[model samples]
Target chain A: MTTASENFDTVGLKQSIEGTFRFRKWRSIAVPFAILGYLIYVFFAFDVAGLASRARPENAAVLLGDFWSYKTHITRDNRSGDVVASVEGERKGTYPAGEGPEWVAMGETTAISLYGDASVQYLPENTAVINVPDFGEITTQVNARAVVLRLPDGKDIPEWMSVSRNRVSIDQGNWRFSMTPARTEVFRYQAGWELFFFTLDSPFYGKSVGELIALAIWEPRVTAEHSNIVAMIDGFWNNKMWRHGDVFWAMGETVLMAFIGTMGAGMIAFPLAFFAASNFAPAVWLRLTCRRLFDFLRGVDGLIWTVILSRAFGPGPMTGSLAILLTDTGTFGKTFSEALENIDNKQVEGIQSTGANMIQRMRFGVIPQVLPLILSQLLYYFESNTRSATVIGALVGGGIGLLLTQAIITQKDWEEVCYYMILVVLTVMIMDTISGWIRKKFIKG
Target chain B: MTAHTVSGTAEYLALVRRRRLYGAILVALFFVLFASGFTVAEDRNAGGFLDGLHRIFDFPKEIFAEAFTNWQNLPRLFVAAIPSLIETLNIAAIATLFGGLLGMALAFLSTRGLALWPRLTPVFRRIMDTMRAVPEIVIALVLIFLLGVGPVPAMIAIAFHTAGALGKLFSEAAENVDLKPVEGLASVGGNWFQRIWFGVMPQVAPNWSSYALLRFEINIRASAILGFVGAGGLGYDLKTALQWGQGKYDQVVAIFAILFLTIMIVDHLSDRARQRLVKGGALV
Candidate 1:
């Protein structure tokens, strides 16, 4: 009877094992299928299918091209018959009167060379002629209230040319030409940011690197008022197109916001953490209240805090910093409190065994153990908050983020957007490096 | 013996005094920086700090008063905000899901011992760093220009950032995983994928999930903020209501309540879940 019962028990155990294996096998299949189903649902719910139609590829092309290249506009007044060349058509980048880019031959008829034999000539009387290597000369003239177009012999008007009653436009590979009753314009696309270092009015506008270096080192003064280097520095600093001075100050403000916010939050949260920590607080109610206050502050979110603070502080770096301070205070409070609760406590007892009072004991014992953790956390938050401050700066209308948003909003200043993006990325990376260095040096030491 | 003890004591006292002096200098420097920074910020601000201090509660009081007067409409407004709130949650969820998966791949590819292409580890690391460096608003604003104002742009932007951020954390966890199981699997002639799946993944999944959960919390906040800049979500609605000011403060209140409740609930749930996961991993 004992052998028979043992045999039955073995069979039952084997059956249960097989049952679990089957369940595991089924789950392995079911989980993936469930995840796939959910993703499909999301794909539809997010309207991924309609996204292609909603997306503007042309805008993307414009943005990408504008990032690394600029277009110089050679525009002629229809009635006055005078041609003006401006980079990006901005007032700040306009070439002086009777002057233009080297590629353009300035005279009664301005000839703009656009990449390998394809050129546009802005003749007098609001007339323009575009010559292509493969395609013959295409001429467009503004006649009274209308634009007239003439194509090459034996060739119909190609798709690259668009003709209307009042306007005619031809889009070659890298060059664009358009003629209307009011104005005739030719846009010549060139690689590299135009007037990035020095605007057209600057004496150092088109100097080679070697020449600039020589001038900076030992060459005679380019301008009489100051040395060559000083003048160059002054010119670059006050560059109207790039506004390097303003940009540097904005970057400083962004860093300042992060610095003030993170340090202030640390100062505010460090003391409160003692009250919140279960091991330190004398009463449960006090700890609970502190925890609840932290939750309230954190739950309000930085965006909401920014909104409220902007109302009080108005829009500036101060408002951004205050928002960051309030939000991070809650974060630091929770983390610091947790750190406090986990401390060893033996050291505290050791200090107490000596003739030290409560304040001295807590200071000598509690602080030394937690200082590294606290400082490292503070530094990490400082680095991360630098990025947050950029976004906050945008909302509050300050810093590089403000400039980035403004450039993006204008929809035409994509080059400036690219510049600001690079600056913000570099700033964050530098902060990350600095914080990591500090943490390693101080905490490890 | 008496002379030696006296000299040693003097040296120790001098060291202590020098350390204290350095500490005092550092503290003084910090205080000066803080004070000067405050003054500069106050000066740059449109309203003086003292001027704005009293009016800080004015806006909040007005909002509360209006909300209390329209208490009957509060429930309706709350109900209306539910869809946008869900959309915000969806954006965060989708971003976290996609980002977590990509982050897992990046971690595997970048981790020292487990990297598929160890020679390219630094390249992958640099890529992650660049991705992390870019603020979400920068990408989102640019995408909003290309894709128009929608959650999709915000989702992609946040996911890109999440992948980079979580990848670093995941790799750190993966580095601590024991190599024994991996070697055992390799001895059986298991392929790279199979070995990683059976060995490394089981070791790091718990920690990875904990990090992903934390990222989900952060991404939720990010998505809401992105909405303020034109992405569709509760933030967009909040912006609209807030722009109307005073009269529609009730709507703003309702939105704020929902956002607060959602954030708190999620925070609590994730905290509990992370504790269980981390503890369970330790037990196993």
Candidate 2:
């Protein structure tokens, strides 16, 4: 007991135990510090400190505001001495002459009823009177050289209102009024996306859900060329502002890109996997070549493939699908070959013993073992590629991604971005569910 | 032959025939769908499939030819792209780090027995699902609108996606963990984080790390893609180079080469690292 043996000794064991504990403790502490240090470095590298200053909280507010609601702009031209109302100030969304929403009366004296008790009136001589909920009436006139603002009771200018020699602006988050030398404008904000289902000119534009249903079921035909129901659908489908038909078509194109890309890759990679698999490869060089080919394809990445393909094919779903096909083919080849290489050899040998040809042996013995794996991978890729297709669509200018980017690029139409985002999320979830279902039903069973 | 044996043989043949018929129908269905999908794609495409097929190599050929003719400039172009490449890698690395931490928390919260508040598991799960469902580009573009243009948005967007994805995997691993260690820790008055860190972490760290590593690989690609959408990285460089047209083909080739090399190297390293981590984890 006193003599310490080489193999077993209390002192040696104690020392080793203490050393391991010290190392473990040191690692536990070092890891967090290392992560923190890296983050600190990344903080500077990403210019995170400047990010706040660079960030536009106002732009974000406008964007978030636009997502749920829209604004109708009523403008009175100073030169013409005339007033007009339009949804979002677009020519296509212009209200017909002397016609507007119930809250608006486009006559010599244009009156606009905003939310709550606030209202606005366009008077003669390009003057505007804004009725505040709490404050008294404020008058603003846009003359040739200056904008005159008359506050209630000679009140000093508030923070909410900005007045200058040529421009006057009053902002109430929901509604705003601005008078310039050239024109006086009022923007009335309302909740919900306006003109989503039907444009201003459509007879079906302002109908309530119940009224629309009644119109479809029993009411007289709104348009002579089409039935009432057909007219409603046509109005919604051909909506100028929202473009529901085009949006749906783009969504479908995105999905189709995924489906065709994944399936096409699978079809190509399946045969290639056999030649690349070590046990089944016809020759060494061929196997290496196939493997290297896969590595090349995968390494090139989809972004490159999309760029290169778009040049030849131009901007379309076809380009996106081909890019995905090219990239996934490499992935499938590598994975499928490895899967093939890992196959149990006894089955193949047993089939061969029955005097079966090589093809027959592969058909009977090899395929069943790997089919489930291959199919599951294909399904998973199919689901993921739906998302990739969206990105690629953005690159290739094809699908819902195109619409989203275009809407974003316009820096207006954030509601469309929100709509497209929702649709993209839903489509991805649906694809996930479908793939999961297939995996469960076919593979697990 | 006996009547009973004859009937049995006939039944067996019928069963085989039915299976064959089903297989044939499935194959035929796939072919039909493939054909129709291709036709639809062709109809909608700017150029016909047949025309585009022959021209697929044209761009690659042009780029490579220009790159080779300017071969002496290739090395310099590659060097110039290194900073952008590093930015891309940093985005991936930082996103993975942050996302992995978030995923650990999400996993712990959503895992049934391991959850601090077991009843809130479904809520956390749905949050993860929603996060997962959003493509990184959506978040990136929105953030770009808010933050102007920078790599930060790309990092955040990728991390968000990585969190949701890694959470799902991490929770799946956590769900299969033995509860004895957790019970042991609780008996000693360890807190929730303590129980997870000391008891469950050792068991699941290897799997979680492996998943995170794979996500890092994916995030690298995502960061590059995000850059193309104005997030500012190598993809941005590549985009500008491509946009410059003929004169900048060498730079385009250089970016592609660097990207290809980085991906290949990282993939190789991670493949090796994952194998080691898993094996070492099992041994311990």
Candidate 3:
């Protein structure tokens, strides 16, 4: 009986060992495959580039057109009496007044009308043409703004000429060109073209037609007059389109939506994160449930949420905002939970020894420690959402993105697109700066 | 000491009062803002709660379900994705390899507060800040105008941005290393070059590699989105497919699947490599 039992026991031991090894091997292979499958599912499920491309052909063509537009030049002393100044007509007003003012060298002058009040510095090499159409009163305000005109002397002539904000009609006969230290009055015409100037603009203002033409032909890069501020705003307003009115309205709504959405998601996520943390919740089932919930939420991208929201809500800011809330909630929950899990557990143990209840222990022990990290992360996400708002806005229709998309498709106006893009960029930069400041002030080491 | 006691109670009380006031103000501000949102124009349905839920759920469902079903057209989607993917990878690869070299050089140059000119450190720091402050996508958009649309512009754009990002990451990693070896190398009359090679790099290599790998992963994901504005990538294909709708859905899905799988595999491999390196060091 002893011999038989010993053989049976050996067999059992061998079988168990073999089974364990096989399981381990399979896991090593299976885990990676599972992960790969999950990733693929997430990616395939969330990919929305196809939607963008339908609008892209025209968008791409517009971009290419913007890049490859005509380079204009005029004869210095031709019969047309010195082609005195040029403007690139856009949705906004003229750039580079007729005579130059004394400022840093803003290379190449491209005359493009900006959507809002803008002060761009032009490079000496190029000329920009700003086309302001007949909007009457609005044109006067723009023309009243100071512009520097370049004269033949390679000197800046500062002047404030009254051209129409939309379009100023000019008569070749009654136009008088004069300059002052503060402002230069150029001829006003009723034929839809007027020139203006400021003294503090650039020295390239009043150069001779030949010199101006040479500059335009040889060196053609116009730097923004306010490079620092312009750089910040260039992303939103510059070379971007507002597809429909929806993108425009949506852009504005996105900011509020992102903030509210983040807050809503964050509130829901915080306690859940604590529960999900391994140190705080030792129970396997609780940990698994929390983790799975987080994965499900975060696994999907915001864009996917947007389409879903659009369908349910019939396309609007509410749809966009709600979509943002759901996705951001999942993401914040996952990140916050990870932070909680990584915290030193000894502090919790210390509080426990003092006979504190769960709430008191969490308040005294966990909150103090995790608050800074959490706040900083939240601020960072807020900054990120400002940009995301623009993108998501494009889908559901409403915001600056809508304006941007429309500009691209309808007008194919690269310059106007550029203007809108700059606005978005500036907004994001401002948000980032604000967030950084708050984080510095409030977050502890 | 018993005869002279220093009481900090008053000071502590004043500090507590100040903090409490600030906290109350913050709480009040939050309520005020939330209240304003409540006054916002309501939807026609008036049942704000259910509408919000439906809107939230359906957006993702419609977008994803459509994208998923459309993923059936594998070949066309692959063609679209492949070029963009290659372009994106090329951008990342070139940026990483070159940026890595440039970052290492900058790390050495600015190691001891501007090696070439101590006065220029602040200037370099400002320049780095400005460069990094503008996101890579923004940079590409600007460059697209100046450089014209093509791979070269995209490459340059990525190169410039990554230089700043990787440089910052590398500098921090280098700065945090143990200085004992550095001092030892210096004591032995080793030159600066030798000190960096023998003293600093050895210790920071693992961290540097880890950071670089992490950056590579991020760059891959970022590059996917660069195509939205003509920078060129799989993102472009994805965008096009989405906009065109219906016929191209399968293609879009296929591209996403490919990219998703690629990312997973790459992430796994990188983690394994990182683990091995970390373990090998611990063993050593």
Candidate 4:
């Protein structure tokens, strides 16, 4: 019923449709299979299976525990027969002789009341006794040669206790007791960071909130030379355990590095961007050269720049800022030039028709269109650079990153690491909010 | 009418003058701040800015001189760096893959209309925010303590941060997607997962892929930096060579060249690919 040409067209259309369907069917199966195969390869490549054995779950437990709690060490030296109670075993947090937490009754016999009915007592002659609620009392003695432990009647050494030739340690849920040849010690685990506000040397060490407020407002000065509030701030700032003042300064330096780096890069890039822009540059070679320069700067990477700059500037905020500046200059140059290239040419033509000079044309036409984009970009970079400065500060040996790395390197200062992490997070979030606000208020508005 | 026109012109002139004056004052204030901040930074630095400016090229020149003399070693050193470079790339690629998957779940959970449980949206958002706020270096360093030095720590750290970063961008894109298809899917008795997978995902996939690509670029840099801090990669090799000082300058040059080339190539390719995706060209 159809002509020959019509029949040919019908046949071609049928074949094309069938081919497309077949291709789609193959693609759908092939893509997923390919991805699955790649993932299988990556699994072996990254050694995901070996990770379980290499991972230290105990270290994770220790880190998590250290983040939220402090331990008080109650020790009696067998040779000197002197008892000392110190927080986290730090000398700065040590309670003075004969002065300890109310939970500990320090006298001829020192009793540490732990959670529940469990308690540890330092008896005379380098001996210690622990009473668990369900179990009978267990005694440990530190002699000249070794530590000897006596278990409760018919009670084998439980899984919580570890015994050796010269040492015996019993780890209860909230309290731990250990006896060695040299000393008998009990570590009472307490929630919250101790000595965070005021050190033991301060007169306001253990004051309640209400009492501190009263002291600050109506009460007589705590220190004769200054008011209660001033003295309180002084003690808090100079607290050897916390070092709040140094931390504050380090945070400021970090912010300063970000600000200087971001704004400086913007200033440097703005002028150079014109030469890189294809629409603005008078000479092709100049445009090409500037573009290459930007690429080279960016390609060098910030890490390399930091290493090189630190070598010159000798590791400080300046080196960090400069490193940020150099890397961002390349970034801003590329982005700004792209922004410039995308501008409406009609506006420039309009200004030119008004007999304006080049500078005037740029100011009246070009800047108006691009200023918002440029500013939003700059503000965004500023916010991110605040975080980068922290990492960069670590490399350059400046800012809060230095303190954080130092704390982390100590392996035992996990609480301080926790504090620094919180501060860094807070600072970054604050910057993000501020920059978002500025972008909304100035650029979008 | 003439008097009204004169007053209007006068008012317009006054407004212009005021705006110009404000701009000038802002510029002045910025310059002042810049100058003062520079002075403070210079004071804190071990070497003054002016003193260090001239000597900046000395180290570079020394390295170049050493490297130039050992030009025969360049190719061998370049070959030596290939494995570390691959490791670095693998870190970035795996992080992007894992982070992109996590970010998708987070975005779906947090975005309105697309959310499975809208009440928990803010909770998921806050979690992402916290994750993003913690820098990769902090996590990497901490994990290094537990896992020891390897690409895995850096990989996990970058992945965590990338998830948070990409989730935010993905959610923003998802928020702007048309809800008609989702409603249509739901009307057919499709479940929550089916509705999102069939309806919202197709619309936002391009934008999400573009973001992931950008994040991939950033993660590359992050992985390298983390490597510099003891994670094993090209950066670790570079550090070791640089520590050896003069004899290993050739290795340093080779590493630098490899890194520079890799970054440039990736940047170029990604830029082109993003343009194609955003411009609605056929994806490769």
Winning candidate number (lDDT): 4
TM-score of predicted structure 1:
0.96
lDDT of 4 at A416: 92
> Please, what are the lDDT tens digits per residue for candidate 3 over residues B22-114?
999998898787546433412511235465654554434554577666545556667657766776776666666566777776665655532
lDDT of 4 by residue, A1-445 (tens): 4698899998999999999889889997998898789778778877878888888989998899999998999888878888999988889999999989889999999888988978988889888888988888999987778888898899999999999989999898678888888888889888999999999889998899999999999998778999999999999999999999999989888889999999999999999999999999989999999999999999899999988888888989999999999999999999999999999999999999999999999999999999999999998898889889999999898899899899889888899999988998999888888888888887892
What docking grade applies to model 4?
A: medium
Q: Give the Å error, residue B274, model 1.
A: 0.6
Chain A TM-score by candidate, in order: 0.95, 0.94, 0.48, 0.95
Per-residue alpha-carbon lDDT of model 1 for A112-179, expressed as tens digits?
Answer: 88887888888777778888889899888888789888889999888998889998888875788888
TM-score, chain B, model 4, is 0.96
lDDT of each structure? 0.90, 0.90, 0.56, 0.91
After superposition on all C-alphas, the RMSD of every candidate to the true structure, in Å, is 2.2, 2.4, 15.5, 2.0
Q: Clash pairs of candidate 4?
A: none
Per-chain TM-score of chain A in candidate 1 equals: 0.95
Model 3 ranges with Cα > 4 A deviation: A1-265, A282-286, A296-331, A383-441, B1-21, B34-53, B56-87, B105-115, B145-152, B180-194, B263-284
Q: Write one digit per residue (lDDT tens) for candidate 3, span A85-116.
A: 32322222233434321221222432222223
* Candidate with more favorable, higher TM-score: 2 or 3: 2
DockQ of each model against the real complex? 0.77, 0.75, 0.10, 0.74
Model 1 CA lDDT for position A406: 90
TM-score of chain B of each: 0.96, 0.94, 0.74, 0.96
Task: State in Å the error of residue A104, model 4.
Answer: 1.2
Ranking by DockQ: 1, 2, 4, 3
